[model samples]
Structure formats: structure tokens, C-alpha cells
Target: MNSPVASNESLVSVENVEKVFRRGSEEIHVLRNLDLQVAQGEFLALMGPSGSGKSTLLNLIGGLDRPSRGTLRVAGEDLHDLPDRKMAEWRARHVGFVFQLYNLMPVLNAERNVELPLLLTHLNRAERRQHVAAALDVVALSHRAKHYPRTLSGGEQQRVGIARAIVTDPTLLLCDEPTGDLDRKSGDEILNLLQALNREHGKTIIMVTHDPHASARASRTVYLNKGQLSTEPVI
Candidate 1:
């Protein structure tokens, strides 16, 4: 596949990327010369069949993994060239992840959970608290700051997860099936919050989802199939 022409405004650029996993004597190709571009502050939804590499693509963009062969750049930095330590620092400063399971610490309260990411930064305790408070407020969970994951509803717990993701005010938000575990009403609410973050907070977001309804909320949607990208939906 030909690589997409990256514009100056593009925040993520993946060109001729390939990812292969080795299983002893065999090699499994997950992505094959895949190309994609995401503009700054753009909300993009990636949809595909199971094992179609949607999450793999998301992980690469988030700097959680690297492609076996290709070039990748995010926010003007060459992700493909960064060392492990540099990559970790860059990821901590620029990328935020929202998981399907919330992934909160079982013993931590909402406030403490949201403050976890800030501990890696140079900020003081007071600064971390202010950031945590603001993030909880954004999710409208300020009143539940002391609530633990087990005590909160599924929707509220997801809100806390979102607060934790945005606590650093990251340059990019990578969500993997963020609403997959919620009911319809709760899912819609989460979608609305994501839209608000994109439109108001100017956060660049890339979401992987199987639900067409969830994908509809994004600014644009793309399909992945057989390790390739297409604008048309995959059937």
C-alpha cells in the first residue's frame, strides 16, 4: 500500500509500516505496509473485524510498541528512531490511554487513581492535587473523588478512568474500546465526553471500536482489513 501524504498539520504519520510476530519457527504478520495520518486535534475512529490490527495500530501510535518495519512520527518526533528511555519519557508527556476495563487500582480511591500518572512528573503534591481535581471535574466526578472502584457504578468508574487518562493534559488520547463495557446510556455519555474533549479541549484522539454507533461520534472513521486501511467500511 502507498503511504499517505503527510501534511504539516499532521500529528501522527505512519508510512509503509509492518508488524510481524515470531512464534518459534513461524512469523505472523499482523500489519502489512499500513499507512495512516492523523491531524492535530482530529478525532479518528478505527474499525475492523476482530484481529484486524486496529488495536495494534493504536498501540504503535501511542508509543507502546514499535513497527517491525516502517517509519512513524508523532508530534514532529520520529518515534521509530527514539531510544527506549526517550520513548518512555515522550510517551509519558504526550500520550494518554483509556482502556476498556478502566484498569484502576483496586485499593485506590478516585482521587488517588487520577493522581498516579502525575507521580512520574516533576510536579509537587499540591500541583498533582490541583490537576487531579480539575480532571475529575472535567469528567463530572468531582463529588466521587473519595469513592473506590468497587463502590462506583460502571459508568462512574469509567469516568474516573477518563479522568486519570487526561490528568496529564496529554497531547494525544488513545482509547481502545473505551465504551465497550458500558450500557447504551453510559456509552453515549462517554462518547459525548470524548467529543467535548476534542472540540473544547483541542485534544487529538484516536479511538479503536467495533460499534458503528460509537464510531459515528468521531470526526472521521477508517476501516482496517487484511492489514490494510481503507476509507470505506469493511463488510
Candidate 2:
């Protein structure tokens, strides 16, 4: 699926971003002077050992958390300045999130689960249904629209989660360990789906993963080490 987004441009920019957690008199810097830039429609992966701050970096980019210092911009908006209310709006309009846990309501059917994000918007019911239907179709899960989470396999549930992430047609997709809980076959399927979403839909994707194979699928891979990105390459 080719992205509907226009020309190649800087969709996300991080400049000297730093995150420091102060506990008592001690300070823990999760990210130190980090710098990253993502072009529109590009797919990038962040990888590192546990506690390397890959997840912290992803959270900062997604507006789930903020940096202690530095300029972080996404979709032309400086994230450091987006207040809580405005950040919520920015996230709803410009960014989509996918998690390893396949965060879905157990009671909701696939379609309804995909519709959850739309509830945050002003889109009417008819428009919302169209968006949900299209997103599911894109993921080839329209057939499972009525199925509950328990009825679907792990892969299917994850696909539903992906659908829900893309239903809002956001420009940026931020994923945290998307395949951490899946079997090889299911993880491969999910990876292929994400590639399609990036290439065909032109969604700029930033994914964090421990799997080398998974990271290899991305156009570029960055390593987070000791609170900063490493210039060294492991491959």
C-alpha cells in the first residue's frame, strides 16, 4: 500500500534531546543528547539491550512522554511545547501507536476495537465507520471484523491492533516492540504488514525491537546505548 502522504520531507526531528529522571539527589539520564530525523514515509528501527533507552526514545517521539531538554518535532509540530490537552489532540491527528501487547478491549469485536481511536475525534458515526472499515481492509482483517479477541489467533489480534492504529490515517506510526510476544510466523506476518503500511501507505514508522531480523526490515536502524545513540554498527 502506497502512503497517501505527499512528498518526502522531514516528518520527525529530534535535536539534542535529553531525558533525566531526578530521584532524591541522584539523576538518571535515560536519553542524553539524542538526535534523530525521519523523512516522510521512511521506516526506521531502534534497537539496543534492555535499559538502553530505546523505549524511552520511542515514548518521547510519540508524545506519551516528554524530554527534559532539546527540541523534538513531529509532523511540523514541536513536541516539547505541546501541553497535555494539545498533545492529546496532536497525537490523535498526527501520530499512531502500536504496542507489543496488542492493546484491545476483550469485549469489543475487531471492528469496534478499531473504532476506539476515532471516538476521540469529531468525525461522525458514518465517517468513523468508513475509516474503521478501510483500515481493517488494509490489514486484510475485514473478515474478522466481528470476531472477539478470544476467537482470533495471536496474529489476528495483533492485526486488529494494527488496524486500530492506522484507522485514523495518521502520518506517523510509533511502535514499541511490536513482535515481542509473537511466534516467528506471526511476527513475520506482522512485519510484512508494517512494511506494506510504510511503503504503500507512506506512513513514517519508528519501531523499537530486540529482534535483529525485525530491525533489518526497516530502512535504517539506530542503536541506543548508555543513554545515547551509538554510531557503531553491529551488523
Candidate 3:
């Protein structure tokens, strides 16, 4: 696969971004003047201690939250300027998120869970089924398609989550502690799957994680602290 980074095309660009949350008279500044660029097909990892705004930055990239200041562009769309409805639509079409806790609906089986993202699209039933099946195949979880979340192992459930995330073939993937809730073995399995997606499928991934081992798997690792980015080369 061609290296998107080598091509020098940015899939996500954040410049002088800040996120501030206000509660009553108090204000919490999560991210301050953060600038980052993720090239297409690059798997970038964000590392920071708790409250360092790592997850906040990921949410901004994924369009889950708007920055209080500065500009953010993902997949060529000006995320900061998009109306709520437009942002939701853009997110459905361009971004896929993998969370630490498998956010699968308890009642939905693996195949059904994978099919949820397609519900936002106009694809017909047949098309949706085809995409769901292909996503399950990508995660090698086709055999568990009929199993409910509770019946599946933690690893299997997370695989189903990955299947759901990729079913849309979104432009980029935002992962927040994707391996955080699993055991060591299961976590490694999840990381391997993420790596495969980035390497073989040309997926651009931005993952927020505290684990050094997880950061090592990404093409580049960036550090955040005190609501600011540190360009110090990763050792």
C-alpha cells in the first residue's frame, strides 16, 4: 500500500484549536491552541495522562464536539463552521469511531450491530446486508454474526464494534482507548486488527490511548499535556 504520509496529503488538519466547557461560572479548558495534522492512511496515536485533553482532541477530529476557537478540517470539510445537522451528516458519511467500551446495543446481534451505521445512509436493505457481511468478514467474526453482545466474549464484542465502525468505509477512524477495557491478550488482538485496517485497507486512524505499547503500533505518536501539544520527538 502507498504511504499517504509520504504523499503529503493531510486527512485531518487542526490549527490553534481550543475547547472550553463552561459550568455555571467556572470554565474548564480542555485543549488549548492545539495544532495537529494527520496524513491520509496514517495511523496516529495520541498519548497523554488523564485530563490532558487527549480524548477531547480525538472528539474534535471525529466531529463529536466543536472546538471553542480555531479551525478544524477533516476530510476537506470545515468542521468548526458546519451546522449541527450538517455536522451529523458529515460524521455519518466520513467518520467512524471505535470506543473503549464496545457501544453495541445489548439487544442487537453481531450482524445487526454492524448494520447500524448503514441505517444513516440511503442504501437499500440488500446493500446494507452486503456491507455488514463484508465488515464482519474483515474482522473475521462472521461466525459470531448471530450472537448477541452478552453472549460474546469481550474480544468478540470489540471485533463486532470494529465491524460496525468500518461498515461505512468512512474516510477516517477515531478510536478512544480501543483496547482499554480488554485483557492483555484481547487488547493485543484489537490493536492487531486496527493495524491491519490501517495497513491493508488504507484507513486513516487517530487513536487516543495512554498505553505506550498501543502508541508504538501507530505510524506516529504525539503527546499532549496541560491542554497543549508537545512536539518533542517520541523516544
Candidate 4:
């Protein structure tokens, strides 16, 4: 694959990327010469088979993992060039992650759980509370802000996770099977919420999903197979 060129509005540029795994004397190739360019504030859905490296691609973009070869630039920073410590900090400031499971602490209330990201910054307690309150409001969970994770429904808990992701106002939101664990109705709510965030907050969302219904909600849907990317715009 040719290296994906960065356009004027590009937020992410993936150039000739490849990811390989070595096991004993054998090597497994997950991504092979893949190319992609994500525009700023674009909502992209990544779909593929279970082993097609969708999560690996998201991880690369989030600075959670590195590709074996090639360049990945997010918001003008070379993701592969950052040191581990700097990468962690960069993710906190620029990237937010939502996973299939709402990985909230068992003892923390929704407000505190949403405040976790803000704690890494210099924000005082009142500032943190303001951010959390606004985030929860965006997801229509303001009424449940004081409830513990265990006390909320699955959809509510996931909404809390979404609030936590956006509290810091990250430019990029990366979700890995965020609705995989929810029922159809609950999943639809989550999808609609994500769309609203993208439309209103201008978040650069890259979501990985296997479910067709979930992917259909994205502005653009791309398929990955055998380590290559195929784009199909969704009307």
C-alpha cells in the first residue's frame, strides 16, 4: 500500500503501516501495508472479522501500541516518536478511549468516575466538577451523577464512561466495540449519543465494531480485511 498523504485538514495520517507478531520462530502478520487518512472531526467506523486487526489499528492511533513499521501522525504529533511516559500524557490530553466494558472503579460514583481524567491535569476541584457535570449533561445522565456504577443500568454505566472520556475535551475519541455488550435498544442509544457528540463537540471519532447496525451510524464506514483498508462512504 502507498503511504497515506496528509491533506490540509487531516487529523490522522497512517502511512504504509504494518503490524507483525513473532512467536518462537514464526511470525504472524496482522496489518500489511495499510493506509488511511482521517480528517479532523470525522466520524469513522472500522469493521472487519474478529482477527482483522481493527483493535490494533485503534491502539496504534491512540498511542497505546506501536506499529512494527510505518508512520502514524495524530493531530500533527508522530505517535511512534513519543516516549512511553510522554505517550501516556499525550493520550490523556488528546485522546479518549471507550471500551466494550465500562471499566469504572467499583467504589466510585459517576461524578468521581468522570473526574478521573481531570485529576491528571491542574484543574482544581470546582473546575473538575464543572467539567464532569457538563459531560454528564451531554449524555443525559446528569440525574445519575451521584449513583455508583453498580447502581446504574448497563446503558447508564456506559453513558458514565462516555462522560469520563469527554470530560477532558479530547480532540479524538476512540471506541473499541463500545456497544458490543448492550442490548439492541441500549446500543442504539449509545450510538445516537456518539453521533451527537461528533456533531456537537466536533470530536474525531474512530470506532471499531463488528455489528452492521452500529457501523451504519457512522459518517463513513471502512472495512479491514487481511490487513488492508477499504473505504465506503455512508450516505
Best by TM-score: 1
Tens-digit lDDT track of model 1 for 193-225: 999999999888999999999999999999999
Decide which is better by TM-score, 3 or 4.
3
Instruction: Using TM-score as the measure, name the better of candidate 2 and candidate 3.
Output: 3
Candidate 3 per-residue lDDT, tens place, 1-235, comes to: 2232345768888999999999999999999988998889889999888899998898889998999999998888889989999999998888889999989999889999999999999999999999999999999998889999999999999999999999999888999999999998999999999999999998999999989889899999989997888855334
Q: Write the per-residue lDDT of candidate 4 for residues 132-159, one digit (tens) a residue.
A: 9999999899999999999999999999
Q: Per-residue CA lDDT of candidate 2, range 69-106, in tens?
A: 99998888888978899999988887788999998899
Query: Where is model 1 more than 4 Å wrong at Cα?
Result: 1-7
Worst 10 residues of 2 by lDDT: 1-10
| CA lDDT of each prediction against the hidden true structure | 0.91, 0.89, 0.90, 0.90
Where in model 4 is the C-alpha error above 4 Å?
1-7, 232-235
Question: What TM-score, computed on C-alpha atoms, does each candidate reach?
Answer: 0.95, 0.94, 0.95, 0.94
TM-score of 1: 0.95
lDDT, model 4, position 182: 97
Off by over 4 Å in 3: 1-7, 233-235
Please give the TM-score that candidate 2 achieves against the real structure: 0.94
